[model samples]
Every structure is written in structure tokens, then in C-alpha cells.
Target: MALRAHVGKLRVHQAASEVAVESVSLARRFRGPGAAERGDQLVRAALSVTSNIAEACGRGSVAEFRQFLLYARGSAQEALSQLDIARRLEPPMLTTVIRRLESRSALVIKQLGRLHDNPPRQR
Candidate 1:
């Protein structure tokens, strides 16, 4: 089906950008009047994760890339905290979406750890 194909494309994602897109969508669902502030914070943190990943991978050295990945991982953690705060206001579908994004965040963090622990050999 179409939904499955779209999800397959997401699985081919790079630089954590796909997860950022999901977070932005999740943020939009919080447009109810009082939710703007928390939503803004969440969006910023989520966007930072994507940008950091891109910046990290662009760095000249493995050490530099690892540093940026640490920053991305930190932003991901902040996003998770914000999600916890906003969970009370959201309906269950939004909660499910946030959970998926959170899982992606965890994957990014774990992959970053692996890269740091066993960096790619440069000839």
C-alpha cells in the first residue's frame, strides 16, 4: 500500500532529517492556543537534532563529527523531555507519532555512539 511505501522511504533516511520532519509534524498538531510555547521549544530542539547531524557529518575529522553527534544526541534528549511535558495535552495518535520519533532519536544516539567507539578507518 501507499503508506507502507512511504514508510519504506523513511527507512532510507539520512542525516536524521526524516525524524526532524516527523517532529515538525508533531509540533503542528499542538496548534491549540496554549500549546504554542511548548510546541516552539519542541520544534527548536527537534530541528537542532537534524542540523547537528548534518553538521556533524560534514566535519573534516572523525573527532569533530563525533562532537556534533553529541550535540545532536543532547538535543534529542531535550526533545524527549519536551514530548513528555506535552503528552498530557495531546490525543493518542499524536502520542504514537511522538513515540516513533523518539525511537528514531534513540537510534541516532546509538549510531553516534558506535561511530565514536569505532570510528571508520581513513586510509
Candidate 2:
């Protein structure tokens, strides 16, 4: 349950990677200093999902993978919350980008839930 475990060879699931990439791209497009700061947080949380999943997959048991996946899911939620705030605080120019990021976050959450329910090798 430690948060300091090594995350090696995360399988880079298609959905999760897409979310992470979109987040990073969105982070670079913010207009204001404040929005940029929040964007950094959003970016970090988005990237966390990728790392957490990789770490989970590296774990020794299905139970452990589930545990780390929970962490990843939490990060995804955190990113979503930050995105909502960014929507209000940011300028009007980034609306489409924000919407896309939100969509990706939602997708990551759904994918994480599915994987948690049926982890690899647990069938």
C-alpha cells in the first residue's frame, strides 16, 4: 500500500496513454500564469494515472494491482476536478481543449474501473 513503489513497464494501455498525452498537450496551451499553475497540477495528475497503472501491473498479485489502480482512479478524479475549476478560471479561448481533456479523464476513469474489475490474469 506504500506510495513509493517502483513503476516499471506499465503496459501503456491505449486509452490511458491517450489521456496522458492529451493532458500534456493541454497543459502547454494555457493563457495565464494562474491557469498555467493549475494546468501543471492537472498534468501531474494525468501523468499519475499512467505511472500508477504501470506500477499496478508490476505488482505481484491481483489484489495489489487493484490497490494501485484505485490510486490511478483517484488521480483521474483529481484531474477532472481541477479541469472543472480550470474551465471557470481560464479564458474562453481554450474551451475545446478543456472539453477534450475532460473527455479523456472520463475515459481513463471508466477504463480503470473495468481493469480493476477484471485484472489481467485473474479471469
> What TM-score, computed on C-alpha atoms, does each candidate reach?
0.76, 0.83
Error of 2 at 44 (Å): 0.6
Give the Å error, residue 74, model 2. Answer: 0.3
How far residue 12's Cα lies from its native spot in candidate 2, in Å, is 7.5
Give the Cα lDDT of each candidate.
Answer: 0.69, 0.79
Q: Write the per-residue lDDT of candidate 1 for residues 32-117, one digit (tens) a residue.
A: 66788888888898888777766665666767766876887788788878878777677776877877777777786676576556
Off by over 4 Å in 2: 1-12
For model 2, residues 37-121, the per-residue Cα lDDT tens digits are 8879988988898888887867777888889899999999999998898888777887788888888788878878987887666
What are the clashing pairs of model 1? none
**Shift of residue 67 alpha carbon in model 2, Å:** 0.3
